[model samples]
Target: MNLRWGVAGLGRGASFVEWLSAIDGCEVVAVCDVSEAALQRFDGLQTYSDYSEFLEKSHLDVVAVITPGPEHATQSLAAMEAGCHVLSETPCVYSIEEAQAIVDVARRTGLKFMLAEDYIWMGWCQNLKKIVDAGKLGDIIFAEAEYTHDCRGGMLVDADGKHYPASAWGSREDLTPTWRAADLPPLFYCSHTLGPLLYLMQDRCTTAIGLNTGAKVAPEVCPVDMESGLLQTAGGRAIRLTNGFCIAHPFSLFTGLYGSRGSIRMVNLGGLQVKAWFEDDPDGGWQDLAMEYEEREDGHHWVTVMLEEFIAAIRADTDPPVDVYRSMEYTLPGICAHVSAEQGGKVVEVPDLRKS
Candidate 1:
């Protein structure tokens, strides 16, 4: 059965809809965006300026909530209530209330809900998962991940919706901060850093304590420059996550896993590279693992793989790999981490919304 798909938000959603349309059993039938200019991009497909009207008219079997971070929770719930399954972008819910609400509604409606956390499906991450599963990394006792991309370049928008760097706002009086520039504390956007770590360890965060390097980089436009979350799993594993968008750094995603027997690390400094050392290896020194492709190709490959898995789950009437509960596991810790950061690194418990 070809599932009818409607996409919300045309910025990233345009790319997603293209990929969804390319899938054999998925049809991109509708798209919704507040901007008429964006809607015009998908000329042949149905488009809407208002989301509610799109939901009513699209007759979509699935809705991809790829809007802004703050809009994800509300949009996902509305789609599920409208009798459509949902595939939402990361940091799925902004608050614990939103998380619980999504969990409740998804359970009550028996609809499929998946978080589009493609980082976990990256080739290096997948390789790490395989090594961990094979007991090469032993028991993962601690992990660290960082996503320090400099986003200050795209932080401001003019009245005409033309984006400019945060620095450009000084010359233009009509520039406004983009949603991402002034969004939640940086740690709240830690899914990219935390998701792949947890995916490899197969654990959920139970508690988190966080700290932030206050908005020193782009204080005028950005809320926070950098934030770090120290999370603890139920099995006594520790995971450290650092997320920064406005900091002065070349785009880098780094992860290091330390286990009882050995450790492995992967980073995108100049390029993607993985280093590993196992206790039982003949040589006791770290060895570099060959990375097949750069980050761009890896990203495209993962999103395709992730969408295929989601489509397969929807067709089989089963839970997606990153279902509602796991979505919260990947997301809620960062929410609580943000709270912890606000409270001066007080330990915050991540609610198990599955029980609620």
Candidate 2:
């Protein structure tokens, strides 16, 4: 069954459009964005600047919420209410309340709600998961993941290799006093770094102690605020997650899982170089494991894997791998970590969404 998709929010939504264009079982039937220029970029696809109008006329099977961080919950709830499934971008909602509300709407509608936590689906991360599930890593003790980038100059890049102006979102006069205040918290964008760790460990974070430096070092270059913090999971394991768009240069994006018997490290995006080290090899002894996967020119095509999984769930009447509940499991910690940072770095207990 081809999943007819109505894509909302054009910036990152454009990536989803490119991905769906390649998938056999998915079609981008309608596109909606606040920008007319964004709508003009796609040829021959039904487009709308107003999402409500798009929903009323598109007759879509799924609505992909690719809007800004603050708009996810409202848009996702609207999509579910319109008798369509929803696939939202990460940091699924700005707060736990919003996440719970979206989850509730999905439950009430009996529709699939998925968070596009793609890092968990990367080829390299999948290989690491296979090894850990095979008991090669033994019991996991501690893990660390970093999504550090020196995008302080700017987050987006244009076709000419020039950085897009940071003022596209909002003007300097409209920003908050500090960088952190200018945009969403750094922990709010933690899923890219946290998803692989949670999936590999098969564990949820029980509590988190977040430490944030409230300084706005480069207010002019990158307006978005930033923060860094440490996360401790339930099984006495710990993982440090850092999200700062204000850093100098694009550095490392990595995750390391240390188990009783050995440990695995996935470096760069798509698990490019996954390294495994056994306890016996203490001195300069680590084997480089081939990722063993082909790279797609358009890496976004991996979203097809996620779409196929959702379609399979619809056919078999089973929940997808990144279902609403699972997405919340990955998201709640980041929410709590932000709350922890706000409370002067207090350790906050992540709420158990599994309970009513």
Candidate 3:
């Protein structure tokens, strides 16, 4: 069945426009952005600068929010309340309370709510999950994942290969500081780094402790550009994550998984490498693996995969692949980590939203 779609927040939402417009069973019924300028780029569609009006008028079955990270929870709650399924871009909400509230909403509405955590669908992550599920990795002992993209205070690059300040794009008619990434604590965006590992482990972090790598170098909101932290799972497995967006570093997702018998690593430097090892191997050695995967002739691999699964779940009238429960499991630790940093690296308990 074809699904009617509306996208809110058109900066990044513009890409959602192109993507959904291309999907076979979806229509871009309407689009919204606080910026009238951003809406102009998407021709021949209903557009609104205000979210409430967009929801009320747009004939939509689902609304994907690609706006600022901070606005996600409120916009998602609005979409669901308006009878639209929600697909929110990462770090679904900033706090456990927000996470719990959205989970409750999805349950009450009986609608699909999926966090667009693309890292979980990335080729290396999927492959690593496969290795673990096959028991080649044995019982997982510990894991480390990092999302280190140094924007150096909102360096948002455009299609022409020119870099612009993030605030410049997110700003409105007044040009106030609306750039989400500028002031956002790095840890607030940790779902990308933490989500895949949690997805692979099939576990939730029960507790988290964080260290703030002071924002004396920070460009905006929080005083810290990076918040490094450790999370402990209910099963006692340890997970480490760092949301390092401020410091000077090449853009890379360096993920490592350590299990009782085997391990895997995704190293992104001059190029990408997927390396792994198993205890039963003759040499018991780490070796580089093939990075090749089935290519998509039509669209972006991870995004297309995500959209198909989302559509399939809706069509089947079944739970989404990444449902609300799993969404919190991937998102809450980062929220807790931020709290921990605020409290001077104190361990903050991560509430399990799945618990009744």
Candidate maximizing lDDT: 1
Model 2 over residues 270-340: C-alpha lDDT tens digits? 33677898776657478988874334333644567777787788667688788888888788787788888
Candidate 3 regions with alpha-carbon error over 4 angstroms: 153-178, 219-222, 292-300
State the displacement of the C-alpha of residue 314, model 3, in Å, after optimal TM-score superposition: 1.3
lDDT of 1: 0.89
- Candidate 1: C-alpha RMSD to true structure equals 1.7
Overall lDDT per candidate, in order of appearance: 0.89, 0.76, 0.80
Q: Model 2 — which ten-residue stretch has the worst lDDT?
A: 172-181
Per-model TM-score on C-alpha atoms: 0.97, 0.87, 0.90
Backbone clashes for every candidate come to 0, 3, 3
Tens-digit per-residue lDDT, 1-356, candidate 3: 67999998877778888878888989998999877777888779998988899999877899998988888899999999889899999878887888889989988889999998877776766767678889998998999988888675545544433445544644533333324445477778888888888888888899999988776553443357678889999988999998777677868878888988888887777578888898899987888877633233333587778888998898888988899888888888887888888899999998877784
Q: Spell out the clash pairs found in candidate 1.
A: none
Arrange candidates, best TM-score first: 1, 3, 2
Error of 2 at 282 (Å): 12
| Local error of candidate 1 at residue 157 (angstroms) | 0.7
